[model samples]
Target: MGTDMGKKESLLFCLDRFLDPWFGYQLPYQDAIVDLLQVVIVSDNTLSVKEAALQLICDYAWPPFPVLEENFERVEAELRPDVSYAMHMDKEIETDS
Candidate 1:
């Protein structure tokens, strides 16, 4: 498990490097970007990383290719922007409880 985590971290680092230059630059490779993002989305990784990838996809592919939009919807459906919980807690506590 530790080895797997190390590998994932390494891959993420490499991806970060590869993507850093294209932060705000326009590119002609729409297909490549979409494909890479889809791989990241379905990869067994942390939510934050997945969200970042999704954001990048939206940034470059905003016109919405079918596959890109489908992946975007999947990530959106799994996110809970309004919810928060205490450390190690399963759910948020009610103030009036």
Candidate 2:
């Protein structure tokens, strides 16, 4: 499990490097950008990292692709459990009272 986690982190690092150059520049190909983001999101081992990368794509990537938007929605859905747990902790505490 540790080895797998290490590999996932390494892959994410490489992807970050690949994305760095394109951050400020205009994307030349829509398909390539979408494909790259898909790879990043799918390769992510943790929900937090996947959510962060998806948010980055939504915030930074230009000429918004529908496929990317769809991917974001899907990732967001996957993240709902974490979000709900974090946001509803107070409600749980109140219920226990």
Candidate 3:
């Protein structure tokens, strides 16, 4: 897990320093950034790492994109493999409570 965490941190650092600065500001490169982020998220099976990547996108990368909420949702759905299952479980727990 430590190695996984390190890898995740390294990827995030690279994205923030290099990819985010290069592709983040431009509208045309937004999809590329999203794709890169998705690759990072899917590269690790750790939920915390995936969540961190998603949070990074929400906090930083999504801001300069054209469509605000739509891009967020689209990128999130594409990156998070268990999103639908998680949502369903949340709803089930909510109704049971």
Candidate 4:
């Protein structure tokens, strides 16, 4: 993974590194990512969109990053912790208010 890779390559490689072992963490795709987003979007106690974005960068984001940090900041700013935090989505309501 250290072969003068371009930004995109590096990002993909880094993601591969994560995704490979991430499975062992029992993070099934639909049950994991989508679930997290749902909880993060609904709960009042979760990270703010900005905070989530920062966390994504700090915890999950890869280097040679193509995205600007603030852009992510803006996106995560709207995340609902409840929606993303749920183990199951049978109880979530889309509060599109």
Strongest candidate by lDDT = 3
The TM-score measured for candidate 1 stands at: 0.42
Q: Give me the runs in candidate 4 sitting further than 4 Å from their true place.
A: 1-47, 69-97
Clashing pairs for model 2 are none
Candidates' C-alpha lDDT: 0.49, 0.51, 0.53, 0.36
lDDT of 4 by residue, 27-67 (tens): 45623443343333333332444244334433442332323
Candidate 2 — worst ten consecutive residues by lDDT sum?
59-68
Which of 1 and 2 is the better model by TM-score?
Answer: 1
Cα lDDT of model 1 by residue, 1-97, tens digit = 1336556546655555445555654556756766766666655567766666655554434333344334444444464231111111222233435
Give the better candidate number (2 or 4) by TM-score.
Answer: 2
Question: What is the descending lDDT order?
Answer: 3, 2, 1, 4
Look at candidate 2 and tell me the lDDT of residue 56. Answer: 45
Better of 1 and 3 by lDDT: 3
Which residues of candidate 1, in runs, are more than 4 Å off?
1-28, 63-77, 80-97
RMSD of 1: 11.0
Output the worst ten-in-a-row residue range by lDDT, candidate 4. 82-91
lDDT of 4: 0.36
- Mark the regions of model 3 whose C-alpha exceeds 4 Å error after superposition: 1-5, 19-30, 39-44, 63-97
Clashing pairs in 3: none
- Relative to the unseen true structure, what is the Cα RMSD of model 2? 10.5
The C-alpha local distance difference test score for the whole of candidate 1 amounts to 0.49
